[model samples]
Target: MSLRIAAAPPLIVPVEDLLRETGAAADEADIMRRILAEYRTTLLGDRHPLAEFRYRHMARKVVGVGSVGTRAWVILLTGRDDDDPLLQAKEAQESVLERFLEPSAHASHGERLVRGQRLMQASSDIFLGWQSIVWVDGRRRDFYLRQLQDGKGGLDPDVMTARGAALYARACGETLARAHSRSGDRVEIAGYLGSSSAFDDAITSFAEAYAEQNQRDFDALTAALDSGRLPRVPRTVEE
Candidate 1:
């Protein structure tokens, strides 16, 4: 009946252990509790179901390649007997495009991301929120939180046939268009794209160019590794 038992989910680790593994200082445990408490109190509020639940465990999650080096953590909370919920907090840094464009209107990066997600997604997680925490390392980091698993699904490109991949790509394009239209001037965008294969061809050409650039970057990385200019970390698998 204890969620902290040895048979607990593989991703779930003791709160203290999660902090240590994520490189937090010894006093991080207490600071983490205060941060979560404030998150629940100010963001979730007393009316939220999660407000009644207690923080039980945490898991450090690896953000994908696009978000490389950003810290993310999933916290487990338990309410009534065996009733558990997982919430993920992902670090949100300034927009990557900031260097080339105007600064974001939203001061808090986490709030900016949360607002964008709410605008783009058809239906976002009810518990989605943002918070700022002064980490043990003395840096104030922004993070956005949401329910860990939402029923999102994706097809694997590696296992897809050419035709299937084309269909999948079109579907992804449509989805992105819909999301963009919701937050942008749809009429202007539609007029710009037009009803022709020219737009498609242009997109394909750009994709091909991008793939070639990506390959060059990979080759440089490989050369660095081969010449002992870069340290290669062994891939680890956990069970």
Candidate 2:
């Protein structure tokens, strides 16, 4: 089957701009060392259940689009049983609540991500928690911990046909209904929807409108690049 997928979004910062923005003067190796030390000391204290697992190595890689310039580290850990794998992704500190309607940082941003993600996802990895610390520079940052590979998978939208999209949309609606039903009256919702096609039509219209807006934003970014306003970054092959 012929497949048409939308182009990926452009990077806000070009590779050169990213290097300049981060003050390339900062020793990345030294920063990693401090982050790792803080990760173990502040986030995973002596009381942590998984402290027994020995850290094998840390691999440096860039991940995420919105927070690309921030520091992120992926740490690998191994148990006495060679087959067991433990992964911890440490993201640099940024305000967790500022971006959303509900904000919370009582524990830390990392902990909040773990908590919210756990609440939304059907299944979650073990060893998810938040760690916080005051850096040597007096700046505070938070890190969230989780096993890197825990049998996670996602469908490729590019591979989805019209039929697949329709079925997926229905499944998403059912899932959302089921999630909301846990907190509200399902009988009332069923009565409101009343086996009507109106809700589906409304949702479809909204989806199309949002998709158009997304396209507009993408075009604006492209225009910025062409006008020499936005810098392009070499996409990292590794996540």
Candidate 3:
């Protein structure tokens, strides 16, 4: 399918049009646009509300410190309503776990992640899909796009009582178990665990230590910046 890029920013246009922009070539965009349309069709079908909206604009967004420098974009879609749906497209990078384990089989890291996540979760973002883009530099980067904060926001931990906290923790454990069962050999895990809390205690201890290490690292970074060991751009943040 053919695609057209908007002449100016903040204008409504087909999202696949981004391929015709600075990132990818026209031919590549044609192929990718079809693929993206197929993905959308698979999730929401031909009559979904999101299918009709034009992508208004895209903006680069900052994510976690760990994900620093990762290419991420947010596209705002506009239709009949004033408050339109938003989608986030995040570039997939190599797994940090690659250091200890075999690399993933999928060529597109974004697809690899989405597949694993879909398998592990009871429900997933219906809009999720992987797109492989070739930049002007001729290097390929994989990205996965999903609806931003769809039906999100719940469980305010700060206000939870002790009973609520315990219930939440139990829920988390059950969810983790389900995810692990999908991702690994559940029978083997059961055999290894064998009604013992030994491994559980070990893992909990490790998690505590890891959290402490993260706090120390964060403190060190703050100290360095304060002492002029590091330089940073000045910005006021509202707490």
Tell me, by lDDT, which candidate is best: 1
Ranking by lDDT: 1, 3, 2
For model 1, residues 1-239, the per-residue Cα lDDT tens digits are 22332433354345567557678666644666777876664353457776677766676776668878888987777888655668889999998799999999987899899889888989877788888988656789999988887577899878999999989888999899999998899999989989989998998999999999999999999999999999866544444
List, residue by residue over 1-239, the lDDT tens digit for candidate 3. Answer: 43333332332345456555666555543444454564464343456655776655565565668778887777666778757668788899889898799988998898888888888988887777777776555788888888877475569988999999889878888989999999999999899988988988998899899989999999999999999999865544333
TM-score of each: 0.73, 0.59, 0.70
Clashes of 2: 0
Question: What 10-residue stretch in candidate 1 is worst by lDDT?
Answer: 1-10
Q: Stretches of candidate 3 above 4 Å error?
A: 1-50, 99-101, 150-162, 214-239
Deviation in angstroms for 179 in model 1? 0.7
- Pairs in clash, predicted candidate 1: none
In model 2, what lDDT does residue 26 have?
A: 51
| Per-candidate total of colliding backbone pairs | 0, 0, 0
Candidate order by TM-score, decreasing, is: 1, 3, 2
lDDT, residue 221, candidate 1? 99
Weakest 10 consecutive residues of candidate 3 by summed lDDT: 2-11
lDDT of each: 0.79, 0.63, 0.73
**Alpha-carbon runs more than 4 Å astray in model 1:** 1-30, 40-46, 59-62, 150-152, 212-239
